[model samples]
Target: MVAPLRVGIAGLGTVGAAVVRLIEEQARTLSARSGRGIRVVAVTARSKAKKRTLDLRGIDWVKSPLALANNPRIDCFVELMGGSGEPALSAIEAALKNGKSVVTANKALIAKHGLRLARAAEKHGGALNFEAAVGAAIPVIKTLREGLAGTGVNRVYGILNGTCNYILTRMEQEGLSFAECLKDAQRLGYAEANPSFDVDGHDTAQKLAILASLAFGTKVAQSAVYVEGISSIAPEDLRAADELGYRVKLLGVAVRTPKGIEQRVHPTMVPKSSSIAQVMGVTNAVTIDGEGIPAITLVGPGAGGAATASAVVADIADVARGIRAKPFGRPVDRLRDTKKAPMERHEGGYYIRLMARDLPGTVAKIATRLAKEKISLESVVQRHPEGVDATDAAKKASPVPVILITYATSEDAIHRALEAVQRDKVISGRPQVIRIEKN
Candidate 1:
């Protein structure tokens, strides 16, 4: 019988420990599927004394993660360390240099250094799999790499960050403020204490960069992604979304444009009728639009110890079965350099909210500005403050909030129009602008 596939896992965090337990508990079944027994031979963590639920009786404890990755007895190195630099990068590098297969859940690492690592993996005759890096347990990477390989994908998009989704979901369902919902998310462990990475749309940007490479066969361009967070999404935004037959979601969207590929992560107004709009809480959903297949939406748990571990194990199983492919569905050298479509060139409908002074010509001036930009108005609604009548509106100097939904127009046009409106001093505050996503 062939020797068992020896595995070395670095980091004993919740996901790492769960991976160890999963491999052992499903050893018999895994062996049957892969036609080769899979065994954990070595492991490393910051602290071996730290109590964990998994039993590590027979597994060799390596003092350094890099040493474990370079261990001759190990065929696969599983990296669960959460960072874009240092130990994780070096360990994976060492393992690949030694021709060992690698499985990682580090999105930041892959987003930052994927091209270099992919080249290394190809040159060294080893597989680098990161199924857990993007949407945990969702099989999005696998789907894009294998299932839809023959199809030409036009767009790749999703709610890639669970923390942002959880916060948005709670805010909409409970009518809570963004701060209140974020606090609840943190308490529930859905968000980090310093949630900027997730809430500010950086996390989604990283994941989208990976997906864009796979779907478009373009170079991973994390730096080119236009990012906007849900921090500005107020309760009023949600209320307006509902009234306008839409829902607000922090979406990571990458699409093929005439000029180039467009990648952006921001609060998007999705139609309430769309499938993705229904995906609530911490769940993630990825929609791929391809040539043959119009669109396919894959939804599942985006993160968590077990969910991420499950994805890691799947990649390991593929490695064991010798089913490895290019990291981005195409050879790293063959991946084309992506031309980033400028955000100002983006064409889409927009939801604009302006606090206009209750003066008679204030509303007309706003329209004049939009008309000057050749931006057509889909709808314009002027709302008075609560308990105020039409007569009171004429007498008061307080600003009346006016909501404008514009027809499809370039982002440049909207910006110029809003700038002109602001200069006129008819609006009381900075206007809120949320892009409308027809998807």
Candidate 2:
């Protein structure tokens, strides 16, 4: 049998430790599948004395991650550290420079420095695999990089953040407020103490950037992606969405348009009948709209130690089997610089909910403002307080909830109309606006 494929691991956290345990437990199976024994020869973590499930008795313990990454005895450097900065970047670079293959579950590092890393990996004849960076255990990266390689993918989008998805799902199912759902998520360990990165849509945006590069052959451009979180989504918004036959989901969408490649992460109102809308809780789903083929949607656990380790090990197995491909599905130098489509010019149906003064001309004023922007309203609903007529409600100065579902219109038109409504003092507070996506 061929010599065992030596592996070095950095950051023995949940996923890293899981990978180590999994490799040992499945050693015989992996060896048979890869035509060689997969071995964990070196490992590094913040603390060597930390209690772990794995038997580190015979494994070589390194002081720094960089040392494990640069160890000559290791054939593959597996990085499970969760950051885009520091020793992670330097160590990955060192591994590639030393002609060692790399497998990582770090989405931030891939999103921020993928191009340079890909170039290095290709130049050094080393494999750089990150199937675990996107949708964990979903094979999304493999689907895009292999299964749909020849298919021209025009759009790629999904529920990439599990924390936001869990919050939204709880809010919709339990009719709980955002804060309540967030607290529950934190308690359940689905969210971090500082959850801004996941809840604010940066997490989805980073994943979207990586997917966009593979789907469109464009360079990763995290900054170019427009982002909006679900922090502002209220129970009323959920009710309104249900009333309109839709479900509110925080989605990361990227599509190739005539203007350019458009990438955005935002709370979207998808048709209730759509598959993506059916995904709830911490589960994730990705849909790819390719040319000349029906849309493909892959749904599974988005994150966890075991799921992420599954992807990481898959990448390692491919490396062991001598299955190497371009990091981004094409030569690094051939990837095109992404041209960002202006979000202001994006045309889509919108769900706008406002708290309007209960006056005779209030609805008329909103209609006129929308018309001025050339926006067409598909439906207008004025909700009054229970046991009160419009006249009595107006006499009491009670604010009425007004919902307007607009026909396809540019984002600029919607913003301009909302600004006009705010300036006119027709709406009491900021309006809740959600983009409506078909499928």
Candidate 3:
């Protein structure tokens, strides 16, 4: 009979408890697949006194995360604690240094200290798997790190955040405002009270940093990602996107360019027919663009205990099967450093929404400014107020919403033209700009 793989888990939150339950429920299948039985030997959490749904009758309650990580009895250390620092980081470091395979779902820590942890794992001869970090149950990390090892990946992008995707989906489907959708998300527990991390794009940025490293074999650096939030998105923008046969989504995009590997997270305009556009609700999706192959897209539930724990257990199974791949697909030394890509140099089509003055010459002035910067327009629409004709609306001195879809242009050129238009007082309020990402 093969020996069982003993597991030590830190932080018995929703994910941790579900992981325990999954291992118990899928014992026979796991044993068959891994060639050994998997067991939860010990666990730790913020509050042991706090009642949990899972029955830990046979499990040892370790004093702390560090203790559980260093326990010699446990062969695999599973970390479900959500933080970029603290006992989580030190515990993971200790586990890897002890030559024990480690599994975690903490994107923040990976983004901040991934290379360092990977280096430690390399030197200690242990596996560091974070399949649940990017997209829960999506298998994106494994796809990028192992399955595509022989292929050349040109670009990898995805809707990695459920909170943002939920908010955006509601806005697009119901024609609701961003604020309204966010409030509903919070009430439904899809978002936190603050919601800045997800809404402001930092959460997506962290996940993107990890994906970029795996896809490009570059050092994972969260600071190198250019981030823009979804809070500025409104219902009007979604309507405009529908009119132009596109959809607005917050996407984390990592692509290779002449300058370097560019990683960014922002509100992007994708064609309505694209696979990414069809992904809605709290679901997540990732698209991998490899050399000489069709684009591969993986989609699934991105959060919740069941989805996340399913991935954590899969990582543990890999450990039981004696499968150990490099932490970032490439050796630590071979991973190149990632320099932050300047947003100003980003070249792509743009969706610009300007509240232009309805007076004569206003539209002419805007066109002249764009032309001066060598920017060409693909389409232009002046949305007059309901029940108001364009000439009549101008006579009423109402501000018209001019939506312009521009051909491929540099970010610097678009900003220059918009700035000139603002200075000329031809438009009111700040202009809304969304980058067009072609499928």
Candidate 4:
């Protein structure tokens, strides 16, 4: 019988504990497949006395993750400690420098320093695997890295964040505003106390940066990706979109164009009949378009301890079986430099909502601005005023809100026209604009 692969898991949080459970439950099957057993020999977290559900009596408990990473008994280092820097990065670096293979679930770390870490792993003759970083249990990173190895990938995009998805899904389905749905998500523990990273689309952008590198063979640049949160989306916009046969989703989109890559995370208007449009709540769906083959989409729970741990264990099993691949699917040196396409060059349809003065020429003025920019309006819906006071019409008139769906046009043109319309005296307040994506 082959000897077991010694694993050191740093961080006994939800994901870390799930990894342990996976190893325990799938031990026999994994052994049969890999011809070697996988065992967690050491574990580390901030506190040793913290109550946990897993059985840790027999395992060695280290006070710090750095000690676990450098432990002589462990052959593989599993980093479940989140955060882009500090103890997590330090431990990962130590493990690689010491010639131990490293497996991590840290998307931020991968997005920020993937190239450097890949190079380090290569120089040290150690493997660096992070299948859990991109899509939880969806195996998306592996799919892009190996399944589509022969195909030339043109674009990769998805609904990468669960928190924003949950909020937007609730807003559309329950007729709740962004704030109300976000509060519910937080109460349900789907969102963190500091939910800015997830709600503001930064988390999805980080994952998209990693996916872009794998799909297009480019260096990952998280900062370059354009991001827009769903916080600005109103319930009225959701209802208006639904009336037009569309569903609003927080979509992380990456497209490779002749000029460069266009990566963005925003609330998009998807046709209600589309498969991804139906992926509501905390679930995630990733779609990849290759040069020849049909587009492939994977949809499942994008977060949760068990799902994330499944991905982590899959990487562990691959390591045990001696299966190895490049971190971003190509040699680090061969990966092309990231060239970011400016946001203005992005072309798409748009959903615009504006509070216009209830005057006769207001509609014509708005239409003229859009026509001047070559943007055609597809549909317009005028909302009736409710709960208006008869005496306050002159002091604070509740102007009519006009919602319009526009035909496809460049983002620059749409912005220029919207700016022009907002500045016009006919419009009562700041106009709200959201892009429409045909997925």
What is candidate 3's lDDT per residue for 123-211, written digit by digit as tens? 99889999999999999999999899999999999999999999999999999999899999999999999999999999999999999
In candidate 1, stretches whose alpha carbon ends up further than 4 angstroms from where it belongs are: none
Give each model's whole-structure lDDT: 0.92, 0.93, 0.95, 0.88
User: Candidate 1 has what TM-score?
Assistant: 0.99
RMSD of each: 0.9, 1.0, 0.8, 2.2
| TM-scores for the candidates | 0.99, 0.98, 0.99, 0.96
The alpha-carbon deviation from the true structure for residue 331 of candidate 2, after best TM-score superposition, in angstroms, is 1.0
* Model 1 per-residue lDDT tens digits across residues 1-439: 9778899999999999999999999999999999898999999999988888888999999999899988999999999987999899999999999999999999999999999899999989889999999999999999999999899999888999889989998888889999999998889899989999999999999999999999989999898899999999899889888999999999999999888899999999999998899999999999999997668999999999999999999889888898769999989889999766789999999999998888878889999999999999999998887888866776786888799999999999999999999999988878999999997
Clashes per candidate, residues 3 or more apart or on different chains: 0, 0, 0, 0
State which candidate has the highest lDDT: 3
Model 4, poorest ten-residue lDDT window? 389-398
Runs in model 4 deviating more than 4 A are 386-398
For model 2, residues 1-439, the per-residue Cα lDDT tens digits are 5899999999899999899999998999999999999999999999988998778988999999889877999999999987998889999999999999999999999999999999999989899999999999999998999999889998999999899999998898899999999998999999999999999999999999999999999999899899989899999899989999999999999988778899999999999999999999999999999999988999999999999999999999999999888989999888999866778989899999999998889999999999999999999999997888878898977889999999999999999999999999978999989999997
